[model samples]
Target chain A: LAKTTQPISMDSYEGQEVNITCSHNNIATNDYITWYQQFPSQGPRFIIQGYKTKVTNEVASLFIPADRKSSTLSLPRVSLSDTAVYYCLVGAFHSGGYQKVTFGIGTKLQVIP
Target chain B: SAVISQKPSRDICQRGTSLTIQCQVDSQVTMMFWYRQQPGQSLTLIATANQGSEATYESGFVIDKFPISRPNLTFSTLTVSNMSPEDSSIYLCSATGLAGQETQYFGPGTRLLVL
Candidate 1:
């Protein structure tokens, strides 16, 4: 499994866009970048996933660099409820099974009113 | 996406006691996982419950301490044996769909407080 590093914390005002980046210097060839959000007293919720380039969904967007060494999760028009810890994971895809990825210290985003 | 549920949302147990957490999924899943999260910390995977076989535990975790049972595809159990104050933490259950499914869903978690 590839190790990931992210900022310890970030602050953003409501209605502003927040971008959290994660770096995986030794990302594998078959690795896919995924992000998750976790609120207090709740399980982590899947946000967005991407292999390369940009992938957007209704909730968030993921941008990956050409080298696949890093990825960023962008949350648009953040609200107070969006304040949560975000985790970035790099999972290696196997032929017939799922590989577990380790969780690192996530980026805590606080949305201020 | 899979919907996962765990039994005994929270419990306070005395030292040397044991607590078994039950995890149920709304649909059949191919992979089931157990995790521990200490207060103000990130999640650490405890083990993977493999159906019809023994569970695979991660380093620093053992079956004697954290025994897991996955009888089928929809349900599993994890028992924290001989609890102590240091064992107090939130236990979470996670699952993934059939083969090739990348998304993993999680349960609300069972809060265990050992006194």
Candidate 2:
């Protein structure tokens, strides 16, 4: 699995767009970048994923750079409820299958009212 | 997305006691994983529960301390044995990772507080 790094915390206000960037410098060719959001006392939820370029969903959008060394999760029109820990995951496919995946200490986003 | 449910949402147990958490998925999934999250920490994979075989544990986790059972495709259980203060954390179950899609869905986690 590729190790990921992001800010420990970030602050924003309602009605603003927020972008959290994740760095995976040692990413492999077959790696896919995935993001998960975790709220207090709840499990992590899938946000978005991308192999390269860009991908968008109703909730968020993922932008992967050309080098695939980093990615960013963009949340449009943030709200106080959007405050949570966001995890960047690099999914590696090995032997034509899956491998042990781990989650790192994610970036904590605090949206103020 | 798969709908997942977990039994005993939260519990407070004494040391040396054990707590079992049950995870049920609405759809049959080939890969079920158990994870532990220490307070203010990230998740660590405890094991991968296979439907008809022994669960594959991750490094630093064992079948003795955290026993897992996967009897069918939709249900599984994780038991925290001989609990201590360090065992007080959230236990979560996830599925649908390796079945085909790259996404994984998680149950609402079981919060355990060992006293």
Candidate 3:
């Protein structure tokens, strides 16, 4: 099992750029690093997914190093709504086997006004 | 992205009773998953509901307790049988539409508070 470690909690202010990093040292070759944001009383929403380098979407940007040992999710100019638990998961998308996507203890980002 | 919906958005049930939560997807999906999340905790995979076969349960979960039904590609249900206070949690349903694109969209979870 590829285990992931991330900060337990973080604090930020509104309009601040918050970056949450996750370390998955034993990630597999076919695995992709994905992030999800979950708010209170709601299911998690997919934030971003990346294989290497950087992938930017309208919501956030995912940065994966060449070694792939870790990944970062950058939320630009976050607001109060961005206050949620962020999960980092590593999984094989098309490995032809059952991909048991494991989510780590997410980083709880509390964005203040 | 896929739109998903779950029925009985929330319910407070009595002990020893059972609650069946329905998950419906907007389109056909190859894989449907059921997860449980205790308040202030991360999500735990309860089982994987296959379209035509018995659902595959994860560790610490069983068919007799968390019975799941996947009748087709677009719908699945997870029943919490013989419920207890410990079973009170948020039950979320998710589905992956494509094979290689492993984006799993989630429904607005069904919150069950077993008293």
The numbered model that scores best in TM-score is: 1
Instruction: Flag regions of model 3 displaced more than 4 Å.
Output: A95-99, B98-100
**Residue A2 lDDT in model 1?**
93
> Per-residue CA lDDT of candidate 3, range B1-115, in tens?
7789999999999999999999999888889999999999999999999889999999999999999999998999999999999999999999885444568788999999999
Quote the chain B TM-score of every prediction.
0.96, 0.95, 0.96
The deviation in Å at residue A97 for candidate 3 is 9.4
Question: Lowest-scoring 10 consecutive residues by lDDT in candidate 3 chain B?
Answer: B96-105
Residue-wise C-alpha lDDT for candidate 1, range A4-107, written one tens digit per residue? 99999999999999999999999999888989899999888888888999999999999998999999999999999999999999887554256578889899
Fraction of real interface contacts that model 2 preserves: 0.55
In order, the interface RMSDs are 1.5, 2.4, 2.4
Residue-pair clashes per candidate: 0, 0, 0
How displaced is residue B92 in candidate 2, in Å?
A: 0.3
* TM-score on alpha carbons, each prediction: 0.97, 0.95, 0.95
Better of 1 and 3 by DockQ: 1
Regarding TM-score, does 1 or 2 come out ahead? 1
Residue pairs with clashing backbones, model 2:
none
Model 3: per-residue lDDT, tens digit, A23-58? 999999988888999999888998898899999999
DockQ of candidate 2 is 0.58
* Residue B76, model 2, lDDT: 99
